[model samples]
Target: MSNSSIYTIQPIEFRLDLKDPFLFTAHHIDHFPAGNTQLGPTVPSTPEKPYQMYYGDVVPGFPEHPHTGFETITLVESGFVDHFDSLGNSGRYAQGDVQWLSTGNGVEHCEMFPLVHQDKENPFELFQIWFNSSPEEKKQDADYKMMWREQIPHVLQTDSNGHQADIRVVSGSFLNTDALSRPPHSWAAAKENRVNIYMIRLEPHAELTIPATTATSTRFAYFYNGPLLYIDGQEIPFKHLVELKPDTEIHLKNSDQVASIMWLEGEPIGAPVAMRGPFVLNSTEELNVAFARYRQTHFGPWPWPTPAPVFPREQERFASYQKGVDVEYPERM
Candidate 1:
């Protein structure tokens, strides 16, 4: 591994509004490109829109669009993603259900709120992670996979200090409920694979420190529930995702209140990135190809065998939002 330049949790300045009206009328303050304007236009683009665990919607039919070259893992923590695809698989992927869709070789999928959830009011939470696959893996298959909370290993552990965490293995080890400090003990192998993830709960004004390691890997953390901080000498503003350099230990404390954090870190996938409306690729040319394919015809050798229900409201709302909207693409790549 190579040493990475140090970085700080530049405060999350960008807020996006949900353009798709049929979807939840919400704002993703961190990275959603269309997060509400009320949060303002200053939301800077960092590593990108991180994985957001969205709950049930005020409406349905979100982010109504197509995708490919990525696998969206929607693990339903509470409600469901009543989804449909060009493959003709249409049904509700409900609470405790996990929806893993590989948009390889191109595929168009839509997520709509279930009729059952309409006004019924259900709490739904899901982690939508954008996992990158090698170009070869991207063309291997287009498919949908689902698993229940029971099927996946959900492990729990508590320390004598009254700190407990529930672990869910999602790609990487997913641990939640409590944050762990520098291990009293250490290991070589575990440290080598250092891409560990955790959801930590912090007590008011509680402080902790993350020790530096030898391997030149970067560490990123997101504070969601509280104003927990990855300190910067002075009180630097906090963000959902904070990036740090290797050998850079972190000092953290609740911002005078209880806090929660989602911490993720891994070696960077140093690839040229190109992204446009649900598609992320290495180059704009690839994106253009994807857009051409998406516009001409739904991607994949097989399109939906039958007609999927049209979310008219979602369509109209997305259209309206698309109007007077300028997608700010990354300038560097």
Candidate 2:
């Protein structure tokens, strides 16, 4: 068998449609002139703001939308996300906080980037990963939870050379560290499934080994930042997605000053997936039903006062669910 564990390393293509209102800005300090302008006419474009804005006449981010049949794990690396849903769920959280939304049956939601830093430029970055569920779990009720920054397990591993790697265990187990917790209906809930989500940052010239999966599973490593890195002696380019083989440890070496990567691994569901805008199901018939129900209900009406909502600048990280569940976290670091 080949010694290489990587299956594929594909670069993500994000061509910004200027009018789309979504901007992908990373690596640079975005400075906005002090004013009331939501988005300046001559805003500098980075990899982050590819689309510029999406229905963000007031703020920048996705507007009201609907989803079903899947879950969204939004890990915020920098900046805060204001969330509202048809089920009366709402939250305002920032850095290192995670929003795990299980939109099992159906739910309407809105994710807007409220400009909390109006006095200066509003800079932010995050990742929203979608996890599929079994056919039986698709018909369950909708729910969500927030993983606060302090609750997430952060471990630092140092090599013999004194270089260190900061590892954030978002889900699953790594080394001796475990994640905060996952939703009951999540695919990562079962230990036998061997699902893992980790964010690793390597100091220059650092070397680290990512543990292997127990059974046959799929693992994806997203090289989002840092200089070129060597994985098992193979060079990994920037902004690439590397798919690795199951049951093999990943030896990574940072060739340059510093590097960071996001790792996602789990057992493949091995089931058919029919996906449409904001929906995923097993068949076209189910997709059609989701659309029909969304049209009929409008997701129980938008409860928030505005399509793009923002909390007061002094507000802390918090989550409030439909069934009177509420959670508030300390200020984000």
C-alpha TM-score for every candidate: 0.58, 0.88
- Per-residue error (Å), model 1, residue 273: 1.5
lDDT string, candidate 1, 33-130, tens digits: 33222211123334644323233233334523578765565645444455666655444555445556667768766665433322232333445545
For each candidate, the alpha-carbon lDDT, in order, equals 0.46, 0.74
- lDDT score of residue 13 within candidate 2: 49
lDDT of 1 at 132: 47
Supply candidate 2's per-residue lDDT for 192.
76
- Global lDDT of model 1: 0.46
Report the error of model 2 at residue 209, Å.
0.6
**Tens-digit lDDT string for candidate 2 (1-333):** 244687776677432111001112122122222214343223545665432455666666677888898888887877767888888888888877888888889887888765566566555677777778778778888879888887888889999899999999988889888887788887777887777888899999999999888556777777778869888988888877777776888898997688989877887677788878679888999998888998898757788787777666666778887634655555543
